[model samples]
Structures are given as C-alpha cells and as structure tokens.
Target: MWRCPLGLLLLLSLAGHVALGAKQGRVRRELAPGLHLRGIRDAGGRYCQEQDLCCRGRADDCALPYLGAICYCDLFCNRTVSDCCPDFWDFCLGVPPPFPPIQGCMHGGRIYPVLGTYWDNCNRCWQAGNHSAFWGMTLDEGIRYRLGTIRPSSLVMNMHEIYTVLNPGEVLPTAFEASEKWPNLIHEPLDQGNCAGSWAFSTAAVASDRVSIHSLGHMTPVLSPQNLLSCDTHQQQGCRGGRLDGAWWFLRRRGVVSDHCYPFSGRERDEAGPAPPCMMHSRAMGRGKRQATARCPNSHVNNNDIYQVTPVYRLGSNDKEIMKELMENGPVQALMEVHEDFFLYKGGIYSHTPVSLGRPERYRRHGTHSVKITGWGEETLPDGRTLKYWTAANSWGPAWGERGHFRIVRGVNECDIESFVLGVWGRVGMEDMGYH
Candidate 1:
C-alpha cells in the first residue's frame, strides 16, 4: 500500500528534467461517484523542488527536521513522496500508504518543535467519495458553508456606553479564566461529533455558565442544545448549522430546558440532518408522534417557566472590552474562523502556519466555528513586547486542543474572533422563587 506511481516523477525531479512524453493534456477520470477529476495534465501531476517537504504519507529523511506539508506546484509533493501525491483520503484510506506521515509545527519557544502529535482519524474514510466526514465537502468548504453563510445578528449593544460603564482601559488584570473562578458552575468540554452545530453547543454552554454565575451557583442548570436544535427554527438551520446571534435571540425569547430533560443528540449521526423533534417537554399526540408542550415535570416541581436570557447583546471588536465582560459577567460566545492549520494545533498560543506543499486551501475550506471565550492573558515576548491571547472553551471534547480549551493570538482579532462577540444575562428557574 505504501507503493506509489512516483518513481519516474522522483527521478525527473532529482535530475532537474521536464516532461517529454505525451502525458500532458486535460484528461478526465472518475475517482468515485460525485468525485470527478479534470485538468490533471501530467502523469506525474505537478512537481516542486522543495527538499524539506513530503507528501501526505511519505518518508521524510533529512538532517534538520522539515516543516509540515507544503504545496510546491500544482501537486502537493515533498522530498520523500517522489511527485504527485494523492489527496488526503485517497492517500490514507484508498491505498493505505506504506509509511505514516508525521508533521512539524511551532509553539511557545519550542526549539525542536516535536512537542506533541495526535491521531488524525477524524477525516479518515475508507468508503469511496467519503473523504473527511465534514459534510461531504472539503474541510474549508464545510467550515465556510456552515459558518460564513450566517448573517450577523440584528441586535447590537452600545459599545460606547458599555466601554464607558466598564472603563475599558482600566489597568485590567494580566490573566483571568472562568473555569478557575466558577469551577463547579462551568460544564466540562463537550463534543459535537460530525454535526456542524458548534454554534448551538457553544451558545448553550455559555448560557449555562451565565445562569450559574449570575445566580451564585444556586441555579447552575445545563441548558440543552437539543432544545434549541429542535425547537428554535426561526431564521436558522438546526443541526446543519446556524448563526450564533440568531441562537442567542432564540434563547432570549424561547429559552431552553435542562440537559436532563432533553440531552444533546449532536454526536448521534455522521451526516447532517434536520433537528430531531423535541421529546422531553412534548407528549405523544397519537400516530407515534409527540407534540411540543410548554410545561414539563421537573424533579422537584411541576412549574413550567422556561429559563431565559434577559437580554442578548453584541460585544464588539475590543479585546479589553471582551476581557472586562468576562471578568465581570461570565463566559461569552464567539464566532471564530477555523483555518486548515487550526486542526493541527495541539498546544500553546495558536497562530496559523501555512504548509506550502499541501495546497491546504484546496483540501480544507475556511470554516466559522463558534466557541466560548472564558478568559484572557498576556505573554511577554523576548523583545519586551507583550503578546495578548484569548482562552477559548471549545465544544470538541477535552481530548482536542489544550484539554478542551485553546489559546489563540488575541488583541489583533486573530481569526476574526473579536469581530462578533456576544453576551447575555440569564434568568434562573427557581432563583426568584426563593428555592435554594
């Protein structure tokens, strides 16, 4: 399986030779159903002269370790793969390459840069035409379609008023983390599975934190993303993806039940599907179907007042303002872009590093991912300049990215994270009723 049609190509590249055969023209072929190939002119595909690079699954043998995959020419080749590497899924799943490929990345003052590695089986598919499970499209396309398509929320908070009230530049603390302050109130990192509903999960998670913090731990209830996924369908798609702001709007008006009542079903499917029907608060209305009802019995009470976000407001593009909000209120929801390089991030403050031989843009599409911004900190640079970063709580489980959290370059709107931040005040179910 490690064998490839790259012997001739590698010899040519090594000898600094150009194609002289008739293998140079637009030839079409079908790799699988719905996956047609066109414009592949050469038998060796494309060539590059980079000595440090390697293909998706090729051997890399050089004195100094090489950088991650880079795109040299039309083909994403490295020194070891000879020339013309297959696509990620084809290379790994279709042919089962002979050797496993290891990639190199940089992080906080690490010299050798081999600090860690992870099992990237998330996109490994053996079935034909099923490359990465990211909505049957390239990684970038999936992200862009799910996140970049959503329109910004209509409700806007008065940034001037908020800054004036909070005093944005008021010598804020160097670091802050919501998990440390309200450890019990904050939920563990979640996994959304193959569904593109991080928007829903992140929104729900942040709302839960707000309710818990606002009520001083007396009303720490885990809100259900399932509730929003099934019930809130006004201006957004349910599981296929939705807008962060629109989700907040739904929470403000129609609130959600606890996870105990309706647990999340995000990881239940491999393909994107319509939101499942709300079953917890609904009763069977004949024909084996359930109809949604407002009231549902809780463990201690039959009362039926949906938990709500008093008001949802946007936190504009100000890092200090965002920090102040988190320090004062609680966690806030953020819609950030996920580039191809982000999936490779393991630890430390993350910044994008392009893999030139990979043609990353062609393989992965840009995606807008929603996460909860829990805190912020500043790392002093060697030149005495300060590098500010934001601590984000992800919904992809603790196994990924800094133990369910990631630190991204902040203050500069890295990944456009600071562009559309949102916050809200949650209403506890029994706080007003004097029920501790």
Candidate 2:
C-alpha cells in the first residue's frame, strides 16, 4: 500500500526535474533533477556500481547509501571528493587511490592527517595510508628502502700514522673536493637500493677512487660492491649486513672485478635477503695480484679483469689530519649513525636536528651506514653563522641529495662521521694499466 505512494512521488519529482530542464534549455548546472544527493568518501568497501546509481550526465544527485553516509558514483563526485566513496577509485576507476588524496593516512580505523608520511612497517602500506607493501608515496620514503649499517667497533675503526710529515706548517684550504681536482678520473656515485650492503658500497667506492687517482687516470674502474657482497663470506652476511673490515679484507686479498662486470643484484624485497651467488672468481697471480677465473657475470660487459687494493688504515678524528690525508690520497670512507631525519635530507648544510626527538623512542631508530667523503666546505648563513660540512657521495643514486651527494656537519664528529674514517690504496701496477 505504501509502495504505490512512494513510487508516485519519485516519478513526479523526476518528471518535474525534466520539465524544468526542458524549459531551461538544459540542466543549468550539474544538479540533475534526480531523487538523491551527493556523498562523502566511502568506507573501505564495494560501493561504486556504475550500472545502477551512476549518473547519465554530471548529476550531483547520484550516490549510494554506505555506512551511515552516501557514496558518490557520479561524474560530479570526481570534481569534489568531499562526497567520494573510499572504494570509488578501486571499484569505479580500477586504480590505486591517487596520492595526496582528499585525506591523509586512513589506517586501522584511525585517520592519520599527516598525509603520506606515516610508514607502518607491519602493514607495509603508505600515502593516504593505502599503499602497496613494496612502495611508498611520500618524499621521505623516496624511491626505495634503506638498510641498516653495522655498528661501530674496533673491527671497522683505524688511524693512519704520520711516517713523515708531507708539510707540517702548510695552511689548509677552508674547502676542498677530490672530484674537482681529479675531474673525470673520479667515478660518480651508484645506487644501493634496498640492500643492507653499504659496507660493501662504501668500501668498494673508496678503493675505486684511490686506484683511479693513484693510476693517474689509467685504471679508472668502478669496482664492484656486488663482488664483495657475494664472494666475501668470512663472517660477513652478504645483504644481511657486514663490517667494512671484512669488505676491505676481500678487496686486499681475493680482489674484485669492475662494476661493469659483476653488477649489484641486492634490491630484493627483504633488506637482508640472500645475495646472488658469486658469478665471477679470481686466482692469485702472485706478487699480491690476481686474475679473473671466469667471464663477467654481465656477459654484455667483457672487462672481467680482477683488481686489488692495499691495506686499509684509519685516520685520526682531528679534522686537519683527515683533510690532509684526503687531499693527498683520495676519497675516504666514513661510518656514521643514520637517524630517521637523515632520510629527509635534500640539501644545505645537514646537522642532526632535534625535530624527531619528540617522537616516541621506538620511532626514533638509528642505523650505522658508510659513505665516501670526497670533500669538505663551509657555509655562512644570512645571520652570520658559520657552518662546516663534509661532502659525501651517497649510494642512493644521482637522483637524490645534491645529485647523489650530501653535506653533513663536520669537525665536531657530527653523526660520528669523523670517528671511523678510513683510507686505502688500489694495487695498480704499470703493467696492469694495459701499457708497457
């Protein structure tokens, strides 16, 4: 009995709307003469069924009842998501919710208003808080996951003795860069991706620079970190993480082929995932030299010749001494603590800020990582404040942080970057350079 009355009312309302539209020459605006209204973002469910509630045109009165609210399914809903359904993107558009959505993180029935910043490790989700397990949508998350560095200890710490002073009274420059002096001889930075193998990356990078600088540009090979990650198995856990001591040991003894030969394959989903098997091997050629026993793992690149390095030695934490060693030798490796805010670094003089100090202790995690210190500089702020910083090459690739480099506060052992600095020499001989 009641159905007839309700049906008649709906028909009359729709007819009046059409008659008005005919008089107005068309729907004056987007509000069609329908019997419904717009809605807000939907709850996580299947609400967008275009066949039923979908509007024939730009109808604001096209929506579905969902969880005590309306879920919009019309073209007008796309213009203003104040009335959009959560599942509209999935059910209607068949796509991930666009980043920086109408809201921030919606997680575990809670709305996080920070917008793509909260990285939930347990759920492996992100951005509007509905991301995939493998990727993130925030600038802080960047392109990939970062790895943990081995903690500092005697195993990875050392100092170089002054056998004889090169120049005791010479005044050092306020700034210096190895790349500026060496130019094309110094190779650019490389990417480590998600692997916890910075121990290998920094070690191999320092050795590559020293060898190239010492050889006077004759043997400028980008030595392979993949070589150490795969083959240096003495108390080292490959992608799981390792100490620089073990990496330097492998470079001095077993040696490694060029990056063009071995190539890195440690970007698996697991930060500590198993590294690929050693595809290339080397045999001692006597006189502290070696030769590759097989072709390069990357068959396309044929330069599989083995390269070795001399012993690794640590430098004094005194800024002057470290500077001299770097200018005379090449880029040196430094072990430092990486805090959560370190990942947010883009440019300018970087000192560990206290911004994250207020966060819960669990969220204030830090890790030890290694990098190549190629140079140093000082900056004067507008307020006449002077800042000193070390220029370093990060393994996160050229797209990040001053084209793959970062400047951290120097001299006072900020992040302990100066505490565990190291230097090494490449074992390049005249004959090894393919010349007489």
Candidate 3:
C-alpha cells in the first residue's frame, strides 16, 4: 500500500466526517455545492435566493411569498424560527422550540396582533377556549365540506322584498331563544365529530323539531341521523359530505326511523361507516329464521319509510322573515359561511368586522356551514351600535361556544346564513307512533 501525505490524510479525515454527517441526514454545507445558507426570508415576507451562503446579512430576491412556505436547515432554523421561517411551527412542530411564541397574524389585509383579540402561532391565528376541531380547518375547506348550491326558485331566495324592508338600524327584542319557548320540542346541540355530517344532523334535528311542533309534543322521537348517513345517496356523500338539497329530498321521498332503531354511528369509524343495509332487511332475515317455510320479501331493504318531510322550502334571507318562519314552523336550517376568526369566538354578538387591520371582503367567501336558527335578538354594543343576531344551535356539543350555541349578526344576512335557509313540514300519523 502507498503511504499518503500528512496533509492529504488530514483532508481525507475531514471529508469522512462530512460524509458521515451527510449519511446521518444532517445539513452539511461543504458537501452540498449548490446548497447555501440563504436567508430564509428577506425583510419583506419572501424567501431569499442569493448565490452566496453568507451575504454579510444582505438579502437577495424572493423565491417564495406564500404564508406557510418552508425553509430547510437545522440549528440556525431552530434558533431563529421567526426570522428564518415563520411557518416552521406549522409543519415541523417539534423542531424549533417556541421560546418566544409568535404573537399575531396578517390575514386578509388585517394585522391581528397576539394578546389583543387572540393568541397566534404558525398552526393557528386566533386562540380561544373552543373545540379543537374548530381550528383544524380553514374557512374555504369548511364551506366546501358543508354547503350545497342554492337555487333562484328557493322560497328563501324569492323573498327579496322582506330583506329590503328590514332596516339594519331598526330596534328589535333584547333577546330571544327557541329553546326557552319550546323547551320540550327544541333538541339539544349535537356533536358531529370530525365528519362532514352537519347536513344530516341539522336536517334530522329540524325535522324532529317540526314533527314535535306539529304534533303538539306527542311525537318526541329523536330521529336518526344514521338513517340519512347510510341510506340517502342521491347527490349526497354521507360523512365525507353531502348537500342540504339532497338531504331534504331524501327526507321527503324516504323518511327516517328513531335513533333507537338506527343509532348515529358515523363517528365510530375513521371515515363515516359504509351505508348500512336498511333495517327492513334485518327484520326480514329474522322473520325468515322464525318461519322456515315463509319466503322473505325480495325487495331492497331501504324502503321502510317511517317518517317523511313534505314540500321542503327555503326561508327568505330577511331577519324578520327568518324570525317569522321560526315562530310559525319550529326551527329552520340555515347555511352560513365560517371563517378563521369564528373559531376563536367565546361569546357576545359575533361580527366578523376586525377592529385592527383586516377587511370584511377578505373572509366574505371563506367556509360554508349549516346550523339550526332557533331564535333572534338585538344587542347593544359598548359604543351604542345595536347588532341584530340570530341564535343558532351548532353541532359541536354544549361544551362549545355559548353552551353549544352561537350568535351571528342578523338583518344583513351575515355569513350568508339568511341566504339559503331551508324549512320543512314533517308528516306524522297515529300508525307511525307504534299504532301497529
């Protein structure tokens, strides 16, 4: 073997250490020729693209300008998280220790500094004592998951006169709650878990309320959301998501049974469980077992219609029209838009107007959600500005904001809640109540 020079041996030894580090997945500058310690972000909120690794604290042109872009490194990134990569906490949660946690967000042209209205981090903007799942999604994603399209011929859409007549400055009642008026009929707020079953839950709850109201408390059965989650498939996708129109159409065409017969099991599995075989199928199987000679009906099992809603119609987008509809026809389902700031709401009248920086137009087209509009009232703010609000029963359980309820700005059709309000008449009969 040839003997190597001392200087060459030293170079080889250094190279070995670098190669070992590279194999261990650590960021090595010498081995990575094209790679350099480019400043993650320039003074402006953009990525740096200088050819030199150390530019003497000078920034280059920006390569990326998105809010949650990633910058790769190791120790430097961890030490200077805010300076190097503002969104590092979002993706690499354990990497950079949040010593001095980031304090605010610049959303939709508004600067919501931490400690003023809400807490801020890379993963979330506003922070409040609300449900965890509330912050898991953005407004756009939530809207896509919940709402179906609206039609011009819808009853709610047709009443442009009602909304036009109602003035925003008009004085209304100090407070109103549907639960207080009809404590026996109004159902408690339900928890839809992470599944997109708000369409089903709201539809079922509204139908149940309508049936109880029409029957004068004789039919107080908790109608099954599982029935809709499993059976109704026309323009609906079960837990993944479905349309309000499709849900109402299913209720009108194929009725549902009590929760005791088919319980809500959508949240039991990862995704909503597969559409189960209808209850009649199991009944037929049991009958066949008892009477060996009797042949089971060779029909599809989903036809066992126990309850139905007739002529599903939409309520007008006017605050008065919605209130009138609720008073006359129990609770109505309304489609509203959700936003990032809405998740942090604890109480008081929820108006999306930012006191500091953002514009209303920024969150105007965020996420869509459906809720049961139980009642409406007006609140006087500290500045003496009167805010009309609709009391809504949410599907996030009682532990959520305002005891499983929320108040949205009314009269102006805030969040489009008044845009696609749907109402229905549930069909009830003596035979339906165990008259068999």
Candidate 4:
C-alpha cells in the first residue's frame, strides 16, 4: 500500500468533490464496465440536483449522488459515501479512482473478514430490503469491479524485497530450538485450565526459547504457559483477551518453570500461588538435573511491569531500514488490521483484502493487540492461486489453528496488511534493548 503522496485527508477531499476539467492526460485509465471519464461540469450537472446534488432519493436530489459524481446511478448513488470508498468491493469495481485490491473472505456474494474468531459481513451485497443471501453482487463481479486492472506494489513484497533470496525455502527453527536455554520455551505442555492468559502463555513460551538459545548452551527446562498465565504480577483480562505487553512483563519478573508444581486451571486466579525458588545446579548432573533447575522463584518480582510498548511499523509505513533490522536481530511483535476477500490458505500462502486507514473506527476494530511475527511463508492455493504470507505467532492457544498460528500473505494484488507498533517487552537485563 503506497502512501498517497497526498495524505488521507487529501484523499477524502478528492472523494468529496468533483474534479474540474483537468488535463485529459491526468485521468486514470478506465477502471471497470460502467465507469468512464466525463467532464467535471457534465458530471456535476448530471449528479447535482437543485437541492442537494449529493442526495440520492430523486435524480435532482443532489445531497449525495452515488459514487459522488465520479460514477453516479440511482441504485449506486443511494449507497453511503463510505460504502463506495475505501471498501473492498468498491475498489475491485473501480468505483473510486486509483482502485486497490480487496481483502477478506468472500462468501454468498459478500465479503466477511474474520479477526481471530469474530466476523463482520458486508451489507452492500444484499438486495434492496432483502434479508435472504441472494441479494448482493456475486463474488466474481465484486472481484472484477473492486480489484480492477489498477495494480499497486504489494507492501509485503516491497518490504521484503531485499530478503527475496533468503525468503525462498526458509524454515523457522522448531519452537524449542528457536529459543533454547530459556526456561519458558513453549515445549512445556500448556495449562489451559488455570492459565487463560494467552498473551502471557505465548510470549513467555517464545521468550524462554529465544533467551535459552541465545544465553544458555542447551535447551534445558521448557517454560510452562500455565505458570505465566496464573502468576499474579502479570494478571489482566483472561486468555480470551488480555494485554500482550503485560504477558511479557510477567515472565521476565517470574521466569517460567515446570508445570508439575503449578498446574493450569484455564482461568486467571484459579489455583494460583507464589513461584518456587530456582535451585537446579550442574554438579556432574545431566539433562534431568538441568530440567529440575527450572523451579519457580520463591517470590514474584516486585516491579514486574511493562515500562513501555514500542511501535512496530508495517511495510506501508515506509520504514524498511528499521523493520529489516528488527527482523534480523530478534523477535518482533506487531498490531495489524485484517480484511475480508483476502482469505486463502494454500500450501502456505495467506491473503487478505485491501483497506485504507482513513476511517478510525474501522481500523481500531481490526486487531487491537499485538503478536510475535516469527517468519514468512509462501504457497500456491489448492485452486492454483499463488501468494506470499507472514507466519504469525498468535496469542490464541494451540487449539485456535495450527498450534495457535496463522499465515498472512506477503505480496499479491489482494493480500496486503498495514502494520502498526512493533511491540517489545522490557525486563531487568533487557531494558537497554528498547525499540524505536
């Protein structure tokens, strides 16, 4: 998603007004079947009514003309401005100039983008006052109309352009090997019953693995997600929803240990208790002794709290240098917006529809929390569709999908993601490694 040299405010202005007789050379190419270039005056005369030129009830009711003078019709004109602008279907059909690709999953002629397990269905697809599924545009028409011929550079591909060579055939180390020595490695079985803190569970598990590999020579004790979830210092909302930053803080203060002592209850505050002391030491002791060393701390750290949450900018933010550095250096967490028609999980490809950040409410509801981005994946859809995608480590438990993970397409006309806030956790020894 290229930033309009002009910002979103400027884009909104273009959508609201009729472009006067500009030079013919500046007009965008014809986008779809019903769309064509006409003089600004003619467009205004045809769309503008004596009262509200923008209005759609009557041909003369100009209050809100369909597609806002760019393309007007009785049925299309009646739709809201937002319904035609920044919408996946609208862009596919080229209703608005400079059309972009569509995101989310298409079902029954409408797009339904899923955020985690939640879904929002597009109402535009339904027929006038018809509740039945037969109402709206077919999937094919919507795709053709919104995702017209105008193709923009894929944000995912553009960001990873320098790493193309490495991307091919790249394989992420097993969860344990990725973060070897850390006691919190995800290898430990999760305690879903007592530790409903998905955020803490995932983060502690990943951090433990990473820290162990980087600091220790061996993959000793695997951290328990249940321990981090039930630990009092990191308590927030339950696993169904909780703060990502808070989860990391819990693990740093109270290093995860064996679940044998502290079991999971699938809910916060259930069977919770103080961590045991760390006592394992190598005295001609082998793997069993090392595993026993993962005992919990006698008492939780007093100041186990998230000092700050660093922002992880997505490809669209144009911070390639910074993003590249983080990906190469260590694990990076990010917040993203999910779209509908962009659903396809092939050999490994994950695609999403395109959506602009012009609307705040829509953007906020997309994805509120952050998750670690382990690596990237590429695959051809079962139907022979091809695309690149991101391999994200989500906060949801293993039962959610592929062990609590999902793939997001990288560069394709339709699968694009806007990333915000690359998240980082601050702990005693890692305070200096703050993200920008």
Q: After aligning candidate 2 to the native by TM-score, how far in Å is the CA of 381 from where it should be?
A: 2.0
lDDT, each prediction: 0.56, 0.66, 0.55, 0.34
> How big is the positional error of residue 111 in model 1, measured in Å on the Cα after superposition?
19
On lDDT, the stronger of 2 and 4 is: 2
Better of 1 and 2 by TM-score: 2
**What tens-digit string does per-residue lDDT give for candidate 4 at 68-111?**
33333223433332122223123234354333322322233322
Model 2's C-alpha root-mean-square deviation from the true structure amounts to 13.9
Q: Candidate 1: lDDT of 422?
A: 81
lDDT of 3 at 11: 13
Error of 4 at 2 (Å): 25
Residue 193 accuracy (lDDT) in model 3: 69
Q: Order of candidates by TM-score, top first?
A: 2, 1, 3, 4
Off by over 4 Å in 2: 1-145, 155-168, 271-273, 433-436
Q: Give the better candidate number (1 or 4) by lDDT.
A: 1
C-alpha RMSD for every candidate: 13.0, 13.9, 14.9, 17.6
**Tens digit of per-residue lDDT, candidate 1, span 367-391:** 6788899988878755567777889
Residue 123 accuracy (lDDT) in model 3: 20
Q: Provide the global lDDT of candidate 1 against the true structure.
A: 0.56
- Cα deviation of 344, candidate 1, in Å: 1.9
lDDT of 3 by residue, 287-343 (tens): 111111212122332323356678687556666767766876688888776654565
Error of 2 at 163 (Å): 8.7
